[model samples]
Target: MRPADHDELNRLCKGVKKSFVHLETRDSYGTEVELPHMATWRRGEPDDFAWLGWWLEMLRGHRAAGRTCRRARVVSEPVSDYQRWTMSHVGLFTDAGEDIRYVARPRLATVPLPGSGDFYVFDDELVLFLHYTGNGTNLSFEITEDDRTVRTCREAFESVWALAAPLHAYRSE
Candidate 1:
């Protein structure tokens, strides 16, 4: 299937009935919406983080509905500047009911991961593989309902999750 746009992806996420699992393997992402904020952080300026309100509300709603939302980030030691900036505000996501974890890249040497870059598995049935440019710009999402693909992604994410530390406990050293 062809790649879908962000609005369509968000719609699919909102329709998730049980769980949402996101696996991020990139150390840096150059998203248009986030770059400006990241720059402000780099400058040591204060950000109220009001821009995250919508996403936070979505997470709160998902939690209220008894749905699970989790993200696992596989990062390198001495994480990239982008990761450092992201970690600084990760508390907001956790507080809003998203479970975010981090796994050091070295720990995954023997682990099997999907050949794709990053992906989101919805309710263990549907998978949305994210495509990105070399510079970390998000391109599009390729979705699939193939059972084998779903199972592989779910297992891979679970394996990674098992080795990850909750953001609060991870020191990133």
Candidate 2:
């Protein structure tokens, strides 16, 4: 694929800004913690420090918010290794609100798409993909009408939710 022109890239970024920012990451913990920071950055004017400060402030603000927030939920297939680690980190910064719902399933048939990391997004919803590839993650996104991808993600989550078991229901502490 040919490299995108600078101006074209800028225009594309602007379009993304109008839509929602999509962030797919292997660092699940960092990305989750970075949400509020990203929100702060977006609310600030475009200065060199704007982005940096936004993330830093978001991290700080999230800690201050409480150990749980009324607005967050943990939906996953309950991978014994990764998801647990990711959610623990998420819990630490979720204090401002106290309504975190942990949704988990024992297994969901993996969806293979010839990639790594699956997908991670911070648009209208924060999406994390579980089955993608070997090591790294894949962060592919396509902008469709009125956030069709967001709906697609929500649907995917719901499907998994239907098949998943509650964490406490299945496993003993």
Candidate 3:
């Protein structure tokens, strides 16, 4: 299925029975939707979280359904402006029940990652591979449920999650 639209993610969240895990392996996301906030954060704005209510609400609804929503990000140290900006918003999602964390690039020096970049695993079964161009526009998505694909992504996420530091700790250091 083409998960190009936002509703598809909502549907997937609704269908998730056990858990939903998202692995984001990028230092910067050049998607236009996030550029404005990234720029704001780069300029040292005190309100980097003015735009995350909707996402938090969605996560709250997902958690209300008795499902777990977790996200782990893989990033290089001295994180990019975009990543720092993104992290500022992680608090919102976490408050709404998504377990969020970050794994420094060096920590996974010998470990391998699944797929090319980011992906969302729903119920640890349906894997939605998020494909992005060099510019990070989130251009395409490939969804699959093949046992190997699901298992690989699931394992990859678990490993990263284990090594990742929670948002508060990462920001404090």
Best by TM-score: 1
Locate the minimum summed-lDDT window of 10 residues in model 2. Answer: 16-25
Worst ten-residue run, lDDT, model 3? Answer: 1-10
Q: Which tens-of-lDDT digit does each residue in 74-114 have in candidate 3?
A: 88889877787777677677889999888888898777787
Itemize residue pairs with steric clashes in candidate 1: none
lDDT of 1: 0.92
Q: What is the TM-score of each candidate against the true structure?
A: 0.97, 0.35, 0.87
Q: Provide the lDDT at 154 for model 3.
A: 90
Candidate-wise lDDT, in order: 0.92, 0.36, 0.80
How well is each residue in 1-173 modelled by candidate 2, as lDDT tens digits? Answer: 12333344334422332122222223333344345554444465332334344333544443454321122233343443345543434433333222223433224345222132233233344333334234423223332233555566545544443443333443442
Q: How would you encode candidate 1's per-residue C-alpha lDDT over 23-62 as one tens digit per residue?
A: 9999999999999999999999999999999889989999
| Cα error of candidate 1 at position 82, Å | 0.6
